[model samples]
Target chain A: MSAGDDVAVVGVGIHVFGRHDGVTGLEMGAIAARRALADAGITWQDVDFAAGGSDAAGNADTSVSILGLTGVPFINVKNGCATGGSALTTAHAMLVSGAADLALVVGFDKHPRGAFNPLPEDWGIGSWYGETGLMLTTQFFALKIRRYMEEHGITESTLAKVAAKAFANGARNENAWRRTPLSEQEILSSRMVNHPLTQYMFCSPGEGAVALVLARSRRIRELARVPVYLRSVAFRTRRFGSFEVFSPSIPIESAPSATTEAAAAAFEEAGIGPGDVDVAQIQDTESGAEVMHLAETGLCEHGEQESLIQSGGTELHGRLPINTDGGCLACGEPIGASGLRQVHEVVLQMRGDAGERQVAKHCRVGFTQVYGAPGVSACTVLTV
Target chain B: MTKTRQFRLIDPELIGGTEQVPRLIGSVCAGCGTVTFPRQRSCPRCTSEDVQPRELAIRGELWSWTIQCFAPKAPPYLPGGVEEFEPYGVGYVELPGEVRVEARLTESDPERLRIGMSMELTLIPVPGASDTLTFAFRPVEEDE
Candidate 1:
């Protein structure tokens, strides 16, 4: 009889995104964990189960030495961008099964500068794919968006508008990386890293860390004020015919993206539809992703983004505010931490703790999604 | 008579057929009729191992496209430094009943590319290694 309401996120913590010269990813992760423990009004010694990981950063369990050797059964996750969501999924299952009363989940990563350079053999493709310069993730996004624009009447203007809104929202959130807002015109005119997508539209690989503390039902009623309930968490990989990152080719037939499937499953498990979500934080790996994911997640209809984005419907004060903390576009996507960052932002918005960039409308339910490499996605539905 | 030499392909397993009219080599699933570029041993759709090698259509329509306006890093990438790199076009060409093969386009200008345009496969030397040949597609000339 366990449901999403059975476990609650009592506390959340984040290390400022973007680069930090001397701080290592593990250090940032430990800092975020300590902050979350403090926010939950408890100590690390109180945690019984723990899970965390990073992409390029060191192993997550090594933090036990830094946070006191409490002998907490800690697990490490390394599922690319979905690392955060996977960790949360594990912690949630443990709490729901009565295996643990209190659990902590942390995600963090530190990637070097420039677009991520994934190896061909790593993705099961020949070296020719990368040797010929077709392995860039940016190229895939540009190609997808370019075709989407042609098919759905999405103009380049709408693409720039998405990035403009992201930076504008980032300007208000002090923790965001690209805090300076740029106009749509400026964004469109920025150096073209890929045709139809400018340099400003993409999120660079950066450094950051985020952590959350979960308390089962009984403890939430006793110790927490305004606990955001973890309604449902869903994770999925690409099915055949679905286009994903690092592919030499794709089938002529089309299928729903991993995000689409995961979002649907999440909403169904939570017993909440897309219409009930007042605010959301979707994977804005690029501006086009925000546009495509908006419809893919069922928040809107296909081809509806053309008008919704142009009219400022996705802004902080708009009808349905998206990426309230600027998302991956402005947050710089730390891979492991990006997914948790979305949940962290949603948790803040739901609790009315989001300072200046809070959504204007009263919000009860929040949705977050993270989609990444080789066709993987993780979605969550949270309610206050 | 001029001495003709054969071109060395970047990956012989990918591009096959005569050097003058190269065609992409893909695999077709005998069970479910699924096709994949660069070939695979099993069907991604039905999980059948009865896949056969097949020569794909040399001509198709541009499904989607982009331009690589920056230099990719080395190691996996074989291109030259940023200064020597030239922006190139990349896209997926849909082969009607077959699969969409992602390849480089000879054209670099975005204005010159359009969706659904006729594209024919061609071979060009790998950017850094002049002696190595790789596959690409170029817009089919109307006159031809």
Candidate 2:
């Protein structure tokens, strides 16, 4: 068995991103699953195991007949917004362990709109802190970036560029939730939800679903479709002294984020550096997020964002195109599906199937990451 | 005079006792000397069981902050209602030789806040909150 021959994301599907009225999250999940099955040139019966992730209730649990009553081992996984990435990690492990020849990973959510107000104890945070109304997800992100800006000299314009790029790319994506392109001024002028985090800069909570079908080398090689192999899947939770969502207080000293830790492990496992990534899809829960994440993912050094973004180096035609499918900025986050949607975009980009927003460079590899509330992160590397 | 009640919204240990200096109470590890606010049971850094509660610095530098323009959801969160909603500043104050604590700010005006500026502990009544004491930070008043 070759080192990279364990399993591949042979097929992928999505139910767009946005409010899907009159449809249950289960229905959206099933629809996306069928699309993924069709894309894989297989059927529900072929799935030997199922892994599901979602933050809301009802849908993901009794997901058996939604795809067909296969009586498979349906393992439900949840890692906040990293739900999809977590599911992929589980499905990949099952395939690598030789536990299943075919595994289906799906993430779908229809959560209540607006910012999340997760309980403290729910994520192991202090109850005294949780009751104080400090649980808004956006403020956590803003606070981290605010400190980063102080140390790194990142200006408000640098943050605006990230949002502008998302809408520009999102305008070309047929499945994007907010296809209306936003100018930097509009994004800057949008109502300030939090200082430096204007309304347009923050992604909304919306509904969507995404799914992936994975298989072994022999099973996937025979298919006519060009295989988008799963190079590595890494997951990491918050470590000590890390400033994260719902954390009321941190130690006197700060530590590297979970994303940084997960990215390091992913790079080691994939046998690739950030430079090897031809395309990427990092979590952009807010405009400043993409900037900080670019540094956290090791794609760039601290304080390099001002020049990197100002130079249009992160644009679709720039040195390193990121979030080509609009990301959460344009798609609005549907927790469970957000991570998988990122992966699906990478799959499309790697396969040379991304129509309007395709990166012109010779794309050999792609990376996607998801960071979520209460300090958790998951990353995946893909190559064909 | 109309009778009124007051209380601390957070833990009592967080407040300064007798001195009225508003020293945040935390825990220090005997093994690695790690300091944590809200007082962790065990040392998160060294996993030391010999951790003890220690009062943190009352004065700090504002590392970062955000002006929350909207009120959060109700039921256990909104000490106040929609009509009472007012924009507020939320920030992390990095204390000398201690941990960074997230807290509400005495001032919400963005113009008055600057990173690295000195801040001192104060108290605020959460809108719609009944008999609760929550702490906040203000630009240290000049020369007392």
Candidate 3:
């Protein structure tokens, strides 16, 4: 269970991401799965297990059926926005437990048309009900951004700057949903969704699927074509009754227990420290999450996030390149697929396959974090 | 003959239930001494099965608030679907006993909302709706 343990990610693949061009979720999953198997230079017969991640919405069974996976244990996982990371964690557990030598984790989503609905009233009343209206994720984060601005003397322009940087990064990504670079002025001028958050600051909903092939390190060395060893994987949910008290909205006397716990476990397993991360791909559900993560993950101290942003230390050429693939901000959230996509980006960076968006030097260890709604977060540290 | 159906907004109690009232439910671990909301079945702190349910404090200080201006996708529960409406403010309220809950603020006026302002939870009946309740945060009054 220590760092440099057994499992390695030998293959990663993704289907094209965008507004659905008539591709069903199952078809997308199958394509990504096939590509991953091919990338690992293995056949379907070599796979021992298959797992899928998606939110509760839509007909998940239809998509699972479309995968056409036969004669192997099939597991379905749903963890809100963290479905992708959750699925991977499940697959890794299967491999570590000796249930499967080779496990395939796939995530895909075709968001239901129209507005994202709140979890049904039956799921317990959401935190967002008032005479004024229901609070959605974007609006909730926008409020937090406003508070951060008020306290830190930051401005809407600072948020716009983050958007601009993400858009610029996205422009270099061929698979990115939004490929056009945007200026701070243009971002500021975009239509506002919530005060201080314009349309450009948010990610458009997109459809896509991603597949990751995980194997025991022994199998990896023996049969893998291109292997990215998984040095450490850790998942943690927020402590009870504390989600609302965390940073961005409220300054906690203590750091976020979930992120801290996950990071510590990951580092312990990876046999490394925060200083050792060559590249980072922390979750950016909102721009504010990125700032909070910078501090929570021990990448920077509290109150130093603005300095990191202002110095461009988080940009592609910075000492620690963070979110080099434009992140969820520009890549568009494919819901269940986002976690694996983060892994995919890191694999590409580590493999030196990222074209214009590549970091200046080789990246040996890449760290990724993914957070789910209802206060669940997962972090994974990958090393070659 | 079957009668045609009419649309109406219902209170949270009717929409959810009285069991979901009090607006908050969390777990307190007997072993490690921790509390969490939405009520986990097992104690996350000690991994002990011994845990008890507890209701959260209704009053707290506003951590922050924001007004949503866009239409959310699906389950058009909120008003003003495609058409934009006067925005509403949502904020995290830091309750006594170290619990923070995300809730809608009753006061939509941004000027009235300040960080650290005192607020309390209220179960308001949705207008034109019956037997249903929604939670909102109201600026605390001098008297209970």
The candidate maximizing lDDT is: 1
Give a tens-digit lDDT track for model 3, residues A1-384: 743348888888888777766777777877888898888888777888878776633434354455555667868888877788888888888888878898888888877543456543433443334222553667656765676667766666667767777878888887777788888899889876766677787776667888988998578887646677777778887763344322222223333657767778888877888888888888776567677676677777766777778778788888888888888888777788888888989998998888999998679888988876656677888877
- Separate DockQ for every predicted complex: 0.85, 0.65, 0.26
Which runs in model 1 stand beyond 4 Å of their true positions? A1-5, B1-6, B79-83
Among these predictions, the greatest DockQ belongs to 1
**Model 2 chain A weakest 10-residue run by lDDT:** A124-133
Model 1 lDDT tens row, A335-364: 989999999999999999999998899999
The residue-by-residue lDDT of candidate 2 on B37-62, one tens digit each, is: 77778988888899998977778889
Q: After superposition, how far is residue A83 of candidate 2 from its true place, in Å?
A: 1.1
The best-first sequence of candidates by DockQ reads 1, 2, 3
Error of 2 at B10 (Å): 3.8
RMSD from true fold, candidate 2:
2.4
Candidate 3, after superposition: displacement of residue A283 in Å?
1.6
* Number of backbone clashes in candidate 2: 4
Kindly list the per-residue Cα lDDT of model 1 for residues B30-73, writing each as its tens digit: 99999899899989999999999999999999999999998998
Most TM-score-accurate candidate: 1
The sequence of per-residue lDDT tens digits that candidate 2 reaches over residues A142-194 is 88888889899999998888999999999999889999998889989989988
Candidate 2, position A215, lDDT: 92
Q: Each predicted model: what fraction of the native A–B Cα contacts (within 8 Å) does it retain?
A: 0.85, 0.69, 0.38
Shift of residue B75 alpha carbon in model 3, Å: 2.9
lDDT of 3: 0.71
